[model samples]
Target: MKRYICFIALLAGMVACKKDTVRKGNDPYRETVVPAIYINKDGISPTRARVGEEVMISGKGFEKNKDKLAILFNGVKAAIISLTDTTVRVKVPAQAATGNVAAQVDQQYFFGPFFRVTGVFEMDTLYPSLVGANGAINNIIPVEDGKYLVVGDFTDYGNSGKKDKLNRVARINHDGTVDGTFGPDAKNGTNSTVASAVALPQSVNGYQYLVAGSFNNYEGVSYVNSVALLNNNGSLAANRIQSPNGKDITVSALKGGVSGSVNNMHVQPNDGKILLTGNFRFYVQPNFNLKTVGTDLDSVHLDSIQVNGLIRLMPDGGIDSTYNYDLAKHMGKEGANGFIYRSLLLPDGKLLIAGSFTKYNGQAVNRLARLNADGSLDASFMPGAGADQAIGNMERQPDGKIILTGSFNMYGGVKVPHIVRINENGTIDPGFNAGEGTDGFINNVGIMPGGQIILSGVFTQFNKLQRNNMIVLNADGSVHATYNSFGGFSAVGDNGANGNVNTVSRVIPQAGEKSLLVVGSFTKFDFRTANRIVRITYP
Candidate 1:
């Protein structure tokens, strides 16, 4: 009787084990092991694969239940082409993005190596593979050869274990490698952020860079405030004049470099004068009033004049009195009601200024105004009603039409989304129809020789099509379906909680190439890690 009872007990235990196996197989959400807690023993073959391509994943337990196993690439489910005891071949899904590959068995995931998605508009892998800037890159100016100068608030560039402490300025080659020879002496590129930059015409000593922002100094050179000139090697450029004390004092900045932040800087044609605009109350200069002062030598005092957000400087860092010295006399004490974001120099010497201000020199310009060469508001180039919001950027076409982009949904009272074209006289150009336009504000625009427009900013859709943060539009303002259908930029929290957190601040087309040099605060492009800068090419 005892032997028979022991036999029955053993049979009952076997039945219970069989039942557990069946239950676990049917429970899709039940995990015998913890989910998302990865064991790093296995990896995927080929590391990177394009959409619809087959990749082999190597790991144990994949063959435990081949029909029940679920393979995924970056959360997108992939189709299993074949399976074995220690390997599984799966095809990447069309919607699969660049991320880790995972295999799920009984609801527990085994993570594999990070996989990159490739195709058109993908990040140029030939470029530096390091994680990009530690902060936002506000501006990029093309320099000699295929290199470019980039400036922003960042103090470091590159990934961990390999980084360059470049401060706010850095020069990069065509392949995106930092030029160590350019700024070897500037341990710290700038004391603060650099907002705008323009390259001066190549002189006998290479290229001079005019940089403006909130920085008060470059390296140890002080009192630069918001503007200064940098030499080819990224050092603060000094004038040839000697100080009153007979010592050769290096003075690279204007007396006090205006009084506040400079958002835009431009070099005039034929003349090397620097034109700057931003939010400032005055431009300060060294006052030589009463140099001897009876007996004791007078200490150099700074003299500040209320000029209100617009000024021009000679190449020698002195105020260009001939341009707008009496600007207050013409435009009142409040030159612009708000900040001037950008200034475009025209061939005819007139200037197109755009910004947040609704009034210029007390005239109701409404965020878009044309200034005569003398700096007074041009009343004839009237933009009736103008932009209802701030104009962030401007682009001039070969046909002389001005393209304006901003946060405004209406231009001159017409519902024209975030972008519009205007005639030379500031009247709206109806030829460019943006349909519903971009869903968000546009930061900048790059016009191609073929009339195609490249736009980038805080947007996900153009004309109701999914274009992400960047898009190419036909001249008539229709989406370039073929170019945008396959691949484009993507961002974190797109169309969700984080609104416009990631942006493409600028898109510059290579002078004679099909590639675009893109820079901004973005962290991704085409679902891959691109950091703040990327060079993407279209087919």
Candidate 2:
């Protein structure tokens, strides 16, 4: 697929600035401003513009006279056609070119007066980087080719002798170290940038791509909800993008839905646009009264909040507003204390969102919810009417059934925990039922190619034996003993440098590969080699 990205920009007054410069070289002249993101519209499909058509895209950091802005057909630079206040007119070139369609810029600045820009570069394929420091490297994810992008939240501001203070992203070297590539001493301080990412690269439309999400700060608050990118190492590739005007955190949340805590992210079924789920809320109150109205609360200054139970993004850096119609919205128990922690997108395009909401779409639901393609509640498919437990991981199996794992004890009328099979209508599929599954919680779930189910979380007694933090379940929700500890991938290691990892957010299971990719907050897989990440394979 064609490689593309958005650019960093300002809005309204944010775009208003004053600068003076003396032109020297052939570089176009204009006022300089920092961009938040970069963009390229290649191979993305049904784009806002076509091959021969023309369109005007206005964004931050733009100048008409100084920046020699040009357009391209498929990356071919057009001739010096025309220019204006905020828009540039040029014929699309016929072929592909490595250089720019125009030079968008400023006359002078610390880096340079003007910056020449070009269309998005198409990347056919690229290997993804596996990034984790046990819990030592909080939110920094390693992108492909030795670049470290900051997921933010790292209290350690100075590292590699960089004391200028840093944001959340930076560039590192191939030796698992910081790269001094973009700036002189680029040290992104804590909270300056933030993102939640994994190391696995995915193939899309026959081309390879990277997936990431964030909780950026649009407001001056601690974490205002945002996400960005870098290659493989830590570096600034683009400006951060904010969520829809209000959405910050999701459906059901752990706590009462904080300001910016998007604990996890996901990908959509058909078009891999990227889905983010954590916890979102509309208002915050002190006492634990979800319906505390007309009780002096109206006069008090309350925090108006919005938790993003789920959201979709466009490749060209726009929010898929249409998705809000297809996904869950204004859901939860119709009070201040409702939210969504995680989700599972099914093969049939339906969504299974789990967290702590007691109602969905004005209907009575427990902690789990089933939504249609257009974001309305699935009234027929109901789960927790009696055994109301939270669903941590929901994955479909080969036999066309869903294996749900989480910290739940009862669902409907049966006793199930750690694992259960739910039919398409959200009822327990009696054909694949086991009395009571696990004695503890299952943070994540995956189906191995060999038909075994991999489970991870804070469990000590999985079947009858003593399991560490992970266990395997068979097709019928019983323990799969064959691959119990079959691989030495998770042994034991020193975790003094790492912190406590609470949840196993995701599990990547492939059919042919001998192992599966596991992710969580734990410092080690089990005890193996400081393994914040490890591949579980058979002997």
lDDT of 2 by residue, 1-539 (tens): 22322223433334344222223334564567655222333311222332334434333233433343444422334554444444444443323222223333333211211112222211111212133332333334445554444333333222445554334444444333445453335334334324355443543322222323344332222222344332323332332322333323211111122334454555554665555566543323222223335543312133433434555544433345565432255322232125666666777776777766676655777777777765567777767482366666577777666777667777776776546778877788876755455566666677777677777666555544445556666776676534453211132326545332344545554334454545445444433343233445453
TM-score of each: 0.73, 0.52
Candidate 1 per-residue lDDT over residues 282-353, each given as its tens digit: 777654333455654534566676778888778766776666566445321456788888888888888889
Clashing pairs in 1: none
Error of 2 at 44 (Å): 62
Q: Which number leads on lDDT?
A: 1
Model 2, which residues run further than 4 Å from truth?
A: 1-185, 188-224, 229-259, 267-274, 282-308, 313-320, 323-337, 380-387, 398-400, 433-436, 486-503, 510-512, 524-528
For residue 146, what is the lDDT in candidate 1?
Answer: 83
For model 2 the local lDDT of residue 326 reads 24
Overall local distance difference test of candidate 2: 0.45
